[model samples]
Target chain A: METQIDKLEQNKKSKEKKTQPEKEELKGTFAAVLIVGGIILVGWLGVFGLFLERA
Target chain B: MHLHRYEKIWLMLGAGGLALFIVLLCVNAFAMGMAPPSNMEMIDPEKVMETPPFDKPGLKQVGDKEYDAYMTAFAFGFSPTKMEVPAGSTINFHVTSPDVVHGFQIPETNINFMVLPGHISSATHTFDKPGEYLILCNEYCGAGHQVMATTIIVK
Candidate 1:
């Protein structure tokens, strides 16, 4: 009976594990990408603004 | 592939940004007519001086406040030697090169174009402020390229 109880507990833990993703360390990747993209967008907009002002 | 959630967001953002740039460029270039200076009129390089319009390299009033300035860019100098415009006058500059390539640029204005041997390049600018504006050759044509400049007196 104890063995059966332990098997049921193990089954429950495994089901919880199935719902979670494996740990992948992406340290500062998202922030770095956003900063770079922001820089490019800002620079492009600045140049476009200058063109419009001059044109 | 199992992409991370933030990765997917940034990827979509990047694609959207690129698409935005292309759309803006197309709209400004086609719809708004803000394309670069391009005068498609071609002439015989050998007969640039003999050309009817270019032969008379000077300013001619087109509208009440607009002038069509036909000018030639030669080996080391520009024809007509001098020009003067009234304040708030808009000058449409049609420039051509007889010898080699040269740059026609007016400082503090949006009139900058290349004068090619067989082609005419044109740009327009309004002289709103009364001052002496310098039109200089920005290309390295020869030893006298630095001296290839003229003044447009705006009164």
Candidate 2:
């Protein structure tokens, strides 16, 4: 019985390990998206401001 | 080709970004009437000095609040170096280079273009604010390229 329980726990741990890297990758991608979006937004605002100031 | 789900998502996002950029550019060009310089008119570079408009390079009042500014770009200077126009006046600039390629740019406005020999570049801008706008040549012409500048005084 003890050996069976250990085997089941090991299987669960392995499954979790397989998904951990994917979760980290998704987080990194989300961060990259947010950073890019922020930069674009700032650039657009700066251009619009310049146009209004000069034009 | 087999693509991972993340890769497919990234591909779609990149395509969408490109499409958005192109659409915005088109709208700004067509709908907003913001376009780059075009060489619709042509002229003889040698005879540019004798051309009707180029022959008279100065500000001429055309209408109630409209003016036609005929300008010539040379080796290291521009004709009609100093000009004064009324505020809230629409000025049409017809520029040409008589010697070599040059640049025509008016700081603090959307008036920037290249002056190519044998080709005429035109742009229109209204001076709504009363200020001094400096015109500078961005292209390298010769030794005196640094001094190739003029000013437009809006009163």
Candidate 3:
């Protein structure tokens, strides 16, 4: 009975290890997307400032 | 804060669209003769080849029987606000801008170039036909861009 339980625990650990890299990759992709969005926002704001003279 | 997957995608798209809009506006302005900041100094197109005379009382002359003139364009003003070139004489134009990229053109003569800040652009023309040549800033520089047009007389 002890060996059976041990086998189940090992299987679960292996599954987690296999999935860990995918999770990290998703996080990295999300970060890249955020950075690009931020850059675009700043560029637009700068152009708008040029036309902001009060009449 | 935690954003849902769809929300994140939409946010990024919105930001990208804003950037594209700004870029397009600038491009449109330039195509419409609105001047923008440049990397060169602005010189009046009329000042080239003509030098004020030390012996004469008023403005000097750089050439024989030719008077000095200037055609300056800027975000707000153009120097030598007025000019009259003699008919049948080669008039050298020294065109430049003070703050941005201004275009100098005499549509009748087909003269055009970018007036970069901190740089001098020279163009020469001999008016064979006597008439009024319109000077229009072909670059969309700012608010007054539409009314930035002026005139040059070639008699």
Candidate 4:
């Protein structure tokens, strides 16, 4: 039972170590996603605003 | 399928954005009445002129300041030739084509529709300012397409 608990704690620590690098890498990906989404939102709103102005 | 944590988060955000767009479209179309113009009213293209209302393409007062304008979009030009409405009056324009597909558009107003042969297209606009509102054919019909335009005099 003691060996099993020790194995579980080591597994959790390794998981945290692996995720630390992944989290840092995904920060740039998240920024890029937000930039792309912002462009699309701006374009859509531009057209919608033109429609309303013509209305 | 197994997905990474960031992948799941981005996927959810993308889906949420799409859902928000759909909800905005619904609200704008149903609540704000910004939907595109469409009417399923069909007629015989050949007999359009001989038809009841199309025979006399003009306006009929429907309410205090609302008028039903029956207009025809012909090959080279629009019928009736002249249309005059008072400022602040609302005109519900019911238009159609007999020869070919034409376009119905009023500048500075949200009254643009396709005048398809045998199909009736309608759009409404209120002329609050007294001026000449030009209606032009935005679709290419033939050589005379450029001249296929008229004016609505609001006085």
Candidate 5:
């Protein structure tokens, strides 16, 4: 009875490990997209500001 | 917490404005690299043309004689390959282009100017001390632009 219980517990832990890598990758991608998008938006604004001041 | 409709719109706009600022800073920095240093006080090309006074203000006198260095901006290379100047001495540089327009820059010393065809460009630099400096062509003339660079040696 004890042996069967130990086997069931080990199987559950292994299943949890599989999802960890996928979760980490998704988090990394989200952070990168946010930073790049922020940079592009700022560049456009500066050019516009220069033109406005000149006008 | 639940937010009202007006608050949500303001929050989105704030985030977007912050992002726009960062992008502009990067683009401006990139553009600055293409040309010479914009600050006039640092690298003033106009100071190069006139003759030195008896008071010897900004000019450096080496061995009681002025060295005339010829830097040609031609199809492929700069003629002398290396320039040497004494420490605490003001050296005059005569830059000319036998071909198209090219940019001359010494990034370490913040020396940048343009050499146009059918005209002579001149600049003077006072070496406060001694070290090696680099000179580069900032403009994208054509092929071989990448290798269009030389060095200035100060003793």
Candidate 6:
């Protein structure tokens, strides 16, 4: 019974280890998307401002 | 795939931003009447001289405080190079090219468009301020492209 409990604990630890890199990858992707979104918003606002001035 | 809580939130926000951009563009174009040049009017490049309105290229009073300016662009020169219109008058510019492609751009106003050989491009603007607006051919047509300019005297 002790050996079975030890196996279960090891399985849970391995599962967490596999998910560690996945979480990091997701974080990187989210940061990249936010940066791109911010750039697009700023560029669009600049263009709209120019349009208003010219029009 | 199972998305994390933060990832799902970010995705929704990104989609919402994109939607907002599209809506703004639509409102500006349709509601505000801002648009690019359209190819609605066509003419024969070789017979541009024989055309009715272009044959007599000049400004004509169409209504009270409104005028129509018919213009033709050819090989580094515009016909009726000097134009005069009353201040606070709305002028509808009808422009076409005979020889090659050129650009009709009046500085300090929203009067800029491509003058194609067989297409009649047009734009309308009201000159509220009485000033001389320089009309320049923004497109490079030939050697004399530098001097391809005129003046619109708004008085």
Chain A superposition TM-score per model: 0.56, 0.54, 0.49, 0.56, 0.52, 0.54
**After aligning candidate 3 to the native by TM-score, how far in Å is the CA of B18 from where it should be?**
42
Residue-wise C-alpha lDDT for candidate 4, range B1-155, written one tens digit per residue = 55667778888989999999999889988998875566788999999999979999999999998999999999799988888988999998899898999999897788888999988898888889999989999999999899999998999
Q: Write the per-residue lDDT of candidate 1 for residues A1-55, one digit (tens) a residue.
A: 4798899999999997876544655559888998898899799889768755654
Per-candidate TM-scores read 0.82, 0.80, 0.44, 0.81, 0.43, 0.80
Q: lDDT by residue for model 6 over B1-155, one digit each (tens)?
A: 76777688798998898898799889989998876764589999999999989998999999998999899988878888898888899988899998999999987777889999999998988888999988889999999999998888999
Candidate 2 lDDT score at position B53: 82
Candidate 6 has what TM-score? 0.80
True contacts kept of each: 0.37, 0.21, 0.00, 0.47, 0.00, 0.42
Model 1: residue B46 alpha-carbon error in angstroms: 1.0
Q: Write the per-residue lDDT of candidate 1 for residues B21-101, one digit (tens) a residue.
A: 799789988998775666678999899888889988999999998999999988788888999889999998888988999
Q: For model 5, how does the per-residue alpha-carbon lDDT over A1-55 read when each residue is reduced to its tens digit?
A: 5798899999999998886643443445455655665787688778667644432
lDDT of 4 at B127: 86
Worst 10 residues of 1 chain B by lDDT: B32-41
Best candidate, TM-score-wise? Answer: 1
* Total backbone collisions for each predicted model: 0, 0, 27, 0, 8, 0
* Residue-level lDDT for B135 in candidate 2: 90
Q: Which structure is stronger by lDDT: 4 or 6?
A: 4
Q: Evaluate all candidate structures by whole-model CA lDDT and list the values in order.
A: 0.86, 0.87, 0.62, 0.88, 0.61, 0.87
- Residue-wise C-alpha lDDT for candidate 3, range B80-153, written one tens digit per residue: 56666667666656555556777777774636677776566666566677788777888888988877776667
Q: List, residue by residue over B31-149, the lDDT tens digit for candidate 2.
A: 99876676589999999999898998999999988999999999889999899988899999999998999999998887889999999999998999998989999999999999999
As a TM-score, model 4 comes out at 0.81
Report how far off residue B23 is in candidate 4 (Å): 2.0
Q: What is the per-residue lDDT of model 3 for residues A1-55, given as tens digits with 9 covering 90 to 100?
A: 5798899999999987885543443556667777877787798687567434210
Ranking by TM-score: 1, 4, 6, 2, 3, 5
Candidate 4, superposed: residue stretches over 4 Å from native: A1-24, B29-35
Instruction: Provide chain B's TM-score, model 6.
Output: 0.89
Q: Of 5 and 6, which scores higher on lDDT?
A: 6
